[model samples]
Target: MEIQYLGHSAFKIKINNTLLITDPFLSDDPDLGIKFPKIEARIVTVSHNHHDHNGVAAVSGNPFIIRTPGEYEVSGINIFGYATFHDEKEGKERGRNTIYLIEGEKMNVCHLGDLGHVLENELVEMLGEVDVLLIPVGGTYTLDAVKATEVVRQIEPKIVIPMHYFHPKFKFKLNPVENFVKEMGVGVPEKTDKLKLSKDKLPQETKLVIMEAS
Candidate 1:
């Protein structure tokens, strides 16, 4: 399977002949100036109902949307959404968020949608071993660099991808990606437009993978 970042928290994951997109941003957002490309997918998973994460209309082909926590299987892809919060206040401040565990072939990928706090022991145990972890590194509305690094340390994913941070088209004043790299004690990350990997090819230890938004 391959994963491609499409700006903000949105990502396109391709498994076999099926395509899955996560967190499509609405066009009404002022920070959005780039065009939402003509994209189609068989499935879509939303972390929350925020304007930046629930633009189902923007995705064509009438894909199945997964937002709540449960077990779902489609096109040989297994999805498990674990309930979480977008703020330390436990959704009182910013509502609930969903942590998606997408299993394809023998690989498991976890997407922490706008997670606002560090993981507890129980949540860490629930996550198990993650081959790839897509996490939020921006502050204010989600986990900042420090908390994101804490989550990374707990989960110990083979591949880590940062999301929901400051970009050229993003108007939010969240911290830069470099801060997350510094927090992780890793060298400057290499940027790529897309990534393809398999179970046998995973790194022996955790590593950060920076993906450029399309």
Candidate 2:
């Protein structure tokens, strides 16, 4: 399987013969100055209606789209979306966020889009075992560095990928990824433009792998 980060909560994933994308961010996030590549995905998912996470139009091809919590199967891949909040106020402030768990090729990849709070015991139990975790570590709109560290501990994924945090190209007010790294007591993680992972390569313990936006 191959994973590429498209900046600001967006990722393009390739598993087996299937291609999918998560949280297609708008090309022009005046703040982020992000110009995503022209992508054509067989399946697209929007974590919520937010402009930064719901750029379904940016994706080419009439892709199968998922936007709510449910069980779905498409292109030989299985997906499960769970209801989550974008703010601690329970949507009173920032509306709902959806955390997606994708299963395929003997791996489970979980993408937490703008998750605002820690998971309850039930949600944590439902997550089960995650091979790769995409989490938000930037504060303000999502979990801050400290909270994200907490979430990592709760889920205990084999590979952890931090997203939605500060980057040179990002034009938002948020804490830098370095803050999260510090909180984790791990030094700066190795940066890769893409990750080609398999069940055999999964680390025995949690590993932080940062992907440079390509």
Candidate 3:
């Protein structure tokens, strides 16, 4: 499988013939100055109603959209969306967010969309094993570097990819990825445009991968 970062929390994941996209924030906006390259996907997963994470209309192709917490099977991929919150106040402040576990190509990829708090033991058990964890490290509306590192320890994924952090083009106020990198105390792998991963290539110890926004 291959994963391509599309800025912010958006990612394009390819497993065999099927392609999946998370948080389709493709349209150019004043807050985020980058315009995402056009790409078609078979599946699109939206975590919440926020414009940055729920721009499903911007994605091309008649994609299968997953917006709520549930179990779904699209093509050959298995997806489980666990109900989470966008704030620590149990959605009282930011509403509900879905944490998606996508199972395909003998690998499980977990995308924590705008997660605002650390996972409880029950939710951790429900998540099972996560090979790749895509988590938000930007503060303001989501988990900051400190909280993001805590979440990383909770899930214990083989590969960690931080998202939703402040970028040079991002106008929003948020923590930079460096804060998370320092907190994690892990070496930063050279940033790549796309990450080519396989089940065999997974590291035994958690490895941090930085992907350049495509």
Candidate 4:
């Protein structure tokens, strides 16, 4: 399986012939001075109803869309959406959020869409095994660097990819990725364009990967 980051919280994942995209934030924003590239996917998953995280219409190919908590199978990929909150106040602050676990090619790629609070023990057990984690490290609307690092410890994924943080082009009041890197006590790794992984060759210890938006 291969994963490509598309600025902010959007990501495109390719598993064999199937294409999957999460939180398609494709609209051009003057504040950010950025535009998403044209991409097609068989499946799209939105964590919440936020405009920034739910741009399904921008994606082509008439993809199957999942936005709620449920179990679904698309193109032989098993997807489980777990109910989560967008804020620590139990949705009083932001609203409900969905954390999706995409299972394909014998690996589990978990995307925490705008997750605002840390996971409880039960929620972590529900996620089971996560090979790759796509998480939001930006503070204001989601988990900050410290909390994000805490969550990473909870999930204990082999590959950790931080997202939704501050970028010069993002124009959001959020913490920088450097904060998270610091909390993890590791020097920043060189940013890569994409991440390719196979179950057999996954790292034995947790690894932090910084990805350049494609």
What lDDT score belongs to each candidate, Candidate 1 first? 0.89, 0.92, 0.91, 0.91
Poorest 10 consecutive residues by lDDT, candidate 4: 26-35
- For 1-214, candidate 4 gives per-residue lDDT tens digits of 9999988889999998899999987566554556777988999999999877887887999999999999999989999999999999999999999999999999999999999999999999989989999999989999999999999999999999999999877666888889999998867664799898899999998899999989
Name the runs in model 4 displaced over 4 angstroms. none
**Is 1 or 3 the stronger prediction by lDDT?**
3
**Candidate 1 residue spans exceeding 4 A from truth:** none
**Against the correct fold, how does model 3 do in TM-score?**
0.97
Model 2: lDDT equals 0.92
TM-score of 4: 0.97
lDDT score, candidate 1? 0.89
Tell how far residue 134 is off in model 2, in angstroms: 0.2
RMSD of 3: 1.0
When 1 and 2 are scored with lDDT, the better candidate is: 2
As for model 2, its CA RMSD to the true structure in angstroms is: 1.0
Models 1 onward score TM values of 0.96, 0.97, 0.97, 0.97
lDDT string for model 3 (97-214, tens) is 9999999999999999999999999999999889999999989999999999999999999999999999888888989889999999886665788988899989998999888888
Which residue runs of candidate 3 sit more than 4 Å off their true CA positions?
none
Which lDDT value does model 2 have at 68? 98
